[model samples]
Target: MFKRNKTRRRRSSRQRGPVARAFFFLVKAGVWFVVLSVGWVLLYKVVPVPITATMLMDPNGHTKDWTPLSRIDRNMVDAAIAGEDGKFCSHHGFDTGAIEKAIAHNQRVDRRGRGHIRGGSTISQQTAKNVFLWQGGGYVRKAFEAWFTVLIENIWGKRRIMEVYLNIAQTGIGTYGAEAGAQRYYRKGAAKLSSIEAARIAAVLPLPDERAVNGATGFTRRHGNTIAARIGVVRRDGLDACIYR
Candidate 1:
């Protein structure tokens, strides 16, 4: 009987070994994920991001010149906020209102079989994507984007988020960042960009490789003007209070 009991205990221990190992492995992975995510966020908060997947994939190669938030003109900030995310400062990471609107619009277009239409990604989401993830449209990529967005919003804060966005966003085909955009397009520093110039640059953000910032015309010109007009509205409504302060 004792021998039988000992044999049963040994069998139970063998059965539990794999489960215990798996549990420990999962715990270690979770801890590492948190540590690495927070570490990267904190590192980029001060150090200029050297490269990103977008920059690498661009045929023109990376051409980024990092500029601090204080160095970049307020007009550029206003224009970016107005054009890309008017409610940036108000929302935490995700903009549910915009997401709902986008979903409704996409559904309408889909019903007509007009293909995918419109994107409601806010500046925070864009920053999260541009900085951490690759460019694509799939559930997997989007899930990771959302995860990173939450991480940055909580770990990096609003100001750091804006700062990184301004510094890493692809402005032109080869150019990246506000400084590079301002220099390449306007032959001036980012801090010296006028409201109109800034708006023109901001207009190209949706399609940086396709849009022309130097000789603004047609759609770019009109969009720039619209964004320029909305800048004041954003300011007055305190939509940029999070970073402006």
Candidate 2:
């Protein structure tokens, strides 16, 4: 009984207070950091600030650095709407139908150990991720992105959302947005882009910061033509007509 009591006392002594408190404080701080980071991500996309590339760099060192959506051409807007989210103006932040189809497709692929991957994330969701969070395929980041996306959609509306996305989205190494991208790619202002020029810009959206618009590569040319072809349809349809009207 005495030996048992001595052992118990020794174990109690081993559990010190300072180390435990420090560990507790660290955990608490970590939780708050995540909360704040997520909050900042949500705010950054909705608010207009010339956020210098946090993840990617602008390599070209062009003089026309930060430009606004008002400076961008209608054709560029049309091309972007056609290529990325055809339903941008209509959806209420989340696209239930598209998400459902994507889920079904993913399941089918998963079962067979291989299949074509599908993504139903809308322009808002993409904006949320690009503006606030890092790029990757993780459930936690995606979940947070979805939450922030909802926040922005509810507060900013279509015009502001598009505005933020256009400004912040990386167009090249150090270049960002249609305005900056236009100058970098074509040595022209965004407001002056022609249909074909706008299409070329849209073609590089998926591979921003890497793909060159003036590369003279077949892939770039072909993709540019494809985007150009779709511009007429989007323009005639109205940018938000499908979703809004």
Candidate 3:
């Protein structure tokens, strides 16, 4: 009886407390997340991304052609910087100033009923979210987006990130990438895009389903024209130097 009691005491002593068990579980999970995320980023650094969650989930179906950065026109690259992220070449991962401005704009818009939502996401953040995450916003998704943004910024660098972003981002109702957008809109290849053509495509990027790349009107046309003009300024000011360099 004493031996049985001694054995029971030893077994109970070996068992972990609830707090200890939870701590160990979280530690294990964190380690696995780090390992797997690093591996995924490393894999994509060398291998072209085959597809993304956004592509698979698009209800309108999708078209894509993976045009290498070298094949894509310089105009397209400049348009993307001008139309989307003006400071793409300078920021690390997050753009705090843009984020702060977006937050303030959103707060002000919220009190005014219906209004356009301003976004502060950088190209890196967009690429990370588009490649590794689903559409829509939530704290959990935002957390994951931040995690992957850091991973890509560290692993892929600016050129690769921009390359992947241009290829993966939704450019129309069913079109994905500059190559597909160019073909669908103008019946031309991405490599042959002029500044105006590229800017129109870039203007379509923010709201691909709604914006018309070919005969854009209203905000889309105005935005495209603005971006088209800025393409030269982008080159002149070297705003897109990182990817070009």
Candidate 4:
């Protein structure tokens, strides 16, 4: 009777072993699937999308204008580099110093949730975020944007990053990139923009769609002058000095 009882227990244990092993195997497979899916998503993000989202207007709904990189003025590029990222060519995907400073600033602002917002994100990081995701603030978005930025900087290079940014960046309510903004406001292509025209366009970059190049906005004009002066410096510096080789 005792032997039969022992044999029954052994049989039960043996039966459970296979089930446990199969469960663990499924878990491992699930993890691998998640990793592969994330990798594919990151890889897919590298491909360029049409400028239509920013440039083309829907018959049913209004849309912002977009400018191709080829149409953008050299001066505009210089102003953006000077104003947004002075060390665009020198840094990798991430700017450690700026990020550290921003983090410290945010920590200080966490007290009231009303402190000044700080951004240490580079042009590549901004482009990655603008192109692939919606706007929000948090470590999750930053991490994802950073990952994508690294991939973009590695795959696309400096010129391509700028090209994508110029094409997609929100310029106004219905304006995007340089060509669309220039054409809509200045009645010219991006390349044809004079220093003043380029400055005016650059000035509105912080809020492109709302402020007009022709409108008599004091802030816009002041900012335009700032960009124009910066453009002069950039031209003297040369393109190679700006773009990473």
Candidate 5:
């Protein structure tokens, strides 16, 4: 009877070994992920992010000059907020309303059997993707994007998110950041960009590779004007107060 009991205990221990190992592995991975993410966020808080996946993947090797938020033009900030995410300052990391709207729009378009699907990623989400993750539409990439977005929102704040977004966003085919984009197109510094110029820059954000900041025409011009108009609305309504202050 004692030998039988010992055999049963051994069997139980063997059964539990893999489960315990798996659990410990998961815990270690989670701890490492948290530590590494926190360290990366803290590093970028001061140092200009040297490179992004997008920049590295660019065939021509893009140009980027890291300019601080204080040095960047307020109009550019307003334009970005207006053109990309009107509720940027209000939303924490994700924009549920925009996501819902985009979902509804896509569903409607799907039902019609024609039209491109739209994305509802906010500036914070975009910054998280641009800075940490690669460009893609898979569930895995999106999951990582969400994780990093939450981290940056909690650790970096709205100002840092905006600053990083403006600095890392793909402004042109071979241009990265507002400074490079401004100099490449307008022959001026990012800090010196006017509202209209900034609006034009923001107008190309949806498809920066295909659009031109200097050669504004048709939809680009109209969209830029619309963004310029909305900038005042966002400012007056305090939608940008979180970072502007």
Candidate 6:
């Protein structure tokens, strides 16, 4: 009976055409992808993420201290929302308005051949990219970003997303996270970061290498100041209510 079953299985395998084999292979691959991606998201929900693709790929050596959200200052959260994603608490991963605005802004160009390029990525999207995906843009990356964004928004929740973002986000050249950035810039911990310090770090987040947090000048300084002022508004207006609640 065993030999008969084995012979039948072998015969079935031999009968499959190239197209049938390819379809089965794709189906198996897709199932594995969903299972692994979902498991990854679930695992990170409670666990402090150990590492990411971006961290390993950085040419400059990375420095990071994985401080939980409780250890990080509230002002830091406020500053991030203010500086990066105002609708972080309200939106479900993506902000269509910001994307539309960015598209419009990027479309407008002056006499030069080069045009201004701006991104509408939110904290959720950034966290998605920082954690599950790689750096840079392309349709493929964008699709993956959208997939991971949905996974995190559904699995990790707002607070967890914020915690991960604050911890993993590149704060400066080779420096990662609020804790490491605080120590590098202020010789202090993230828990003790002031509004200005937090805002400065948040301001430099988008282009950490280009912006200076220690003595930010020009656009960096101005953006930091703006975020600093908006921090209070974030708290007052409950822009960070989802996380707090």
* TM-score for each candidate, following the candidate numbering: 0.88, 0.71, 0.94, 0.69, 0.90, 0.95
- Which 10 consecutive residues of model 1 have the lowest summed lDDT? 12-21
Order the candidates by lDDT, highest first — what do you get? Answer: 6, 3, 5, 1, 2, 4
lDDT (tens digit, per residue) of candidate 6 on 68-186: 99999998999999999999999999999999998877777433447547789999999999999899889999998999999999999999999999999999999999999999999
Q: Model 5 segments beyond 4 Å from truth? A: 1-16
Clashing pairs in 4: 64-174, 65-174, 65-175, 65-176, 171-208, 171-209, 172-208, 172-209, 173-209
lDDT of 4 at 105: 92
Kindly list the per-residue Cα lDDT of model 5 for residues 47-146, writing each as its tens digit.
8899999889989888999999888998999999999998898888989999999999999999998976888999999999999989879999999999
Q: lDDT of candidate 6 vs native?
A: 0.94
Please list all clashing residue pairs in model 2, or write none if there are none.
Answer: 57-174, 58-173, 58-174, 59-173
Give me the candidate number with maximum TM-score.
6
Candidate that beats the other on lDDT, 3 or 5, i.e. the better one? 3
lDDT value, residue 169 of candidate 1: 94
Pairs of colliding residues, candidate 6:
none
Off by over 4 Å in 4: 1-48, 51-68, 100-118, 239-245
The lDDT values for all models are 0.89, 0.75, 0.92, 0.71, 0.90, 0.94
**After aligning candidate 3 to the native by TM-score, how far in Å is the CA of 64 from where it should be?**
0.6
Report the backbone clash tally of model 4: 9
Worst 10 residues of 6 by lDDT: 107-116
lDDT of 2 by residue, 1-245 (tens): 99999999878756858788688789999899778865775576445654544444434553335556667777887788877777787787778888899899999999998955777888898888877677778999988788779777876677777777777766766666788778777888889999999888888887766577887477778978888898898878776553334
Where does candidate 3 have its weakest 10-residue lDDT segment?
Answer: 12-21
Q: Judging by lDDT against the true structure, name the best candidate.
A: 6
Q: Predicted candidate 4: what Cα RMSD to the true structure?
A: 7.7
Q: How many angstroms is residue 65 displaced in model 4 relative to the true structure, after the best TM-score fit?
A: 6.5
Q: How many clashes does the backbone of model 1 have?
A: 0
